[model samples]
Target: MNEKIKNFADSISPLIFLDFLFESRKNLTRLIIYFVISLGLIITVFFMQLSYSDSSRAGVINAFFIIICTSSALIGGTYSAASITSEKEKKTLTLLRMSGISGVQIIIGKIVSGFIYMLALSLPYLVLTLLLTLFGDFNFFRLAGGLFMWAGFTFFYLAAGVLISVLFKKNASANSFFYFSMFTLHFLISLLDEWFYRPLYDYSSYKFFTNLSPIDVWVNFSSSHLYGSTYYGNDGISSLFNGTVPDYAVITLLYILFSIILTLFAANIFEKYLRWRED
Candidate 1:
């Protein structure tokens, strides 16, 4: 068992370490700047939330959700989408392949490294927000649910970015497509939810469409947890679950399935591309 564990670690360590070292070497200065900016923004928001009256705790929570969701989508998506394209542009991808790393290893390494960087940028702000929630009479379970939802969304964004990066040869093109798709999806969902579903109080339609938006999923689930069924026209906790499974749980499962499918698709494309290059 120990030998098997050691072998497994050895197989992956080089890929992870090399990717991390390369990223740090290339973007150390930019990373430092981003960290400073993110820290400043988080501190400012924390203080601003503190200034709000106790009665406005819900507003504060909503603000935090907005910040987290926007940052995760933008920063995570950009980094992940650029990870492979940047390597190809630098002409180092062939060198790595020549070193005997499989295409799967390359994809996995990029995804892992991108996820680490994303978390580094996101976790501090999330922790600060969680701490603030403690003083705002928020339920711990609700906060946990929100965190889980955000984490799942972040993973989905990273996976989508990776798939996009593999599809587009140029970093700029991949990034443009990624941002455009993300914004369009979010905008359309919000418009539909507000302009169509909300006015009609169409519970079925609202639930179906809003679940497509990660932001809405988080908001609705968290609101159900915090305010119970009374908050959403009697469609709350009970409405969130179908039999035994919660609506958020169903959404999360779908996201995970989609991510897995995208990753597999990217890996197949990458492998074929590598083979074609060799020929």
Candidate 2:
């Protein structure tokens, strides 16, 4: 067992990690500059808007939450969607593949990069969270719940992005495919829940099956947020390890697990692609 673990670890390429780290570091500087500018803007807006404000805590929270979540989706989604395909476009992916690094290693590297990128983005942005406190009394759980759910969801999407990029040779094709497919699927899942899953939950273990869809996992928390979905009833890092496993946390874990499964599947396809290119 120990040998197997070590082998698995050894299979991962250090080069991918190094490249990802370098790319993340490059972005870090830009993010810091943006943070500084945004902070100034926020303070200016805050004082200027204060005179005209009649918003409650909940109202402000929801508005800010929507803005942050939307921005994260757009930026994170674009970055991830381009990650693998950009390498492919530059011919670097071909070199990496021919260099004897396994498909699994490549996918692992991309996922780790995504996670590291999330950290690189999120850590400095904590100051924004502090800035958010100015709007009203901040609900820690809401922030926690949003962050946890987004992290898991982002991981899933990042995997999907890499998979799409692996399947396509061009950056434009990969990005287009990722965006349209995810949007369509998100809608389809919402419809299914509305038409079938919601009424059947009391009588079936459908939530489990539904939760299997990352779309469903998202809807479970996001849909209910309109009515103040603040607690970590079954989600997030803190809720995952203490005592009973939260159902949502379980779903999040399933996402990570499925990500691995998807990565393996993508690797298989990637290896086949490499073989085809050689032939």
Candidate 3:
């Protein structure tokens, strides 16, 4: 038990994680620029559509989802992408391997720390959303659903980033591939609608294909009105009161499960890319 505890402790040494966070803080300018641009764009969009014959509240909510999802995905691509590649690039993995550190330990540390960073990035947006709810009839329940959806997206991207980090030698290549693959995952399915799947929207296989994108999960959540939605996201966030499962809830569960699978897969093959040099 003592040995197990010690291994876990060493895996997530506070000093290492703190330094990692410090480096992130050093990139404050880029973070701020991204925040400002995304926030400005969404706010502008909300006000612009408010004057039109549209659902202002729902529009803003959807915009917030887009911003939050994009930011969280970028965080995963950067932080998780570097988790293993940095150690490998600096030749520190050899020392960790020699020091009796296991692949599982490394992954746990990376994911835990990356999750913290992801939360930090999302904090401002969360606060803003809360404040918005105060003045409007904005459903707090919906906000909760959106936040849950973002968490699922965060986990999925983090897992994908780690797997990419393991496969690529350089962080640059890993980040690029992470972004490309994720975009492909989320966007490519929709293209089928323009050509083939649009007419078959009600088909089981069609529903299955649409469900593959996290964006679809968010869309399902955004469509809910005052009353809670049903199992397949055919209702609102208040569905818990109605004893029905919301669509996002099911998708979030799937995301967590998929992330676990990806993490395990990465850990299983982690050692192939690490080697020790003796003097």
Q: Which candidate should be chosen as best, given TM-score against the real structure?
A: 1
- Root-mean-square deviation (CA) per prediction: 4.4, 6.2, 5.4
Backbone clash pairs in model 1 (N, Cα, C under 3 Å; residues 3+ apart or in different chains), count: 0
Question: For every model shown, what is its TM-score relative to the native structure?
Answer: 0.77, 0.65, 0.74
Q: Give me the runs in candidate 2 sitting further than 4 Å from their true place.
A: 1-13, 16-18, 21-33, 41-72, 127-144, 193-254
Q: Model 2, poorest ten-residue lDDT window?
A: 230-239
lDDT of 3 by residue, 212-244 (tens): 567777666666532344335322333444646
Backbone clashes in each candidate structure, one number apiece? 0, 0, 4
| TM-score ranking, best first | 1, 3, 2
Comparing 1 and 2 by lDDT, which wins?
1
For model 3, the local distance difference test gives: 0.71
lDDT of 1 by residue, 111-154 (tens): 77777766776777777767678867666755775677667777
Query: What is the model-wide C-alpha lDDT for candidate 2?
Result: 0.62
Give the Å shift of residue 238 in candidate 3: 15
Candidate achieving the largest lDDT: 1
C-alpha local distance difference test of each model: 0.72, 0.62, 0.71
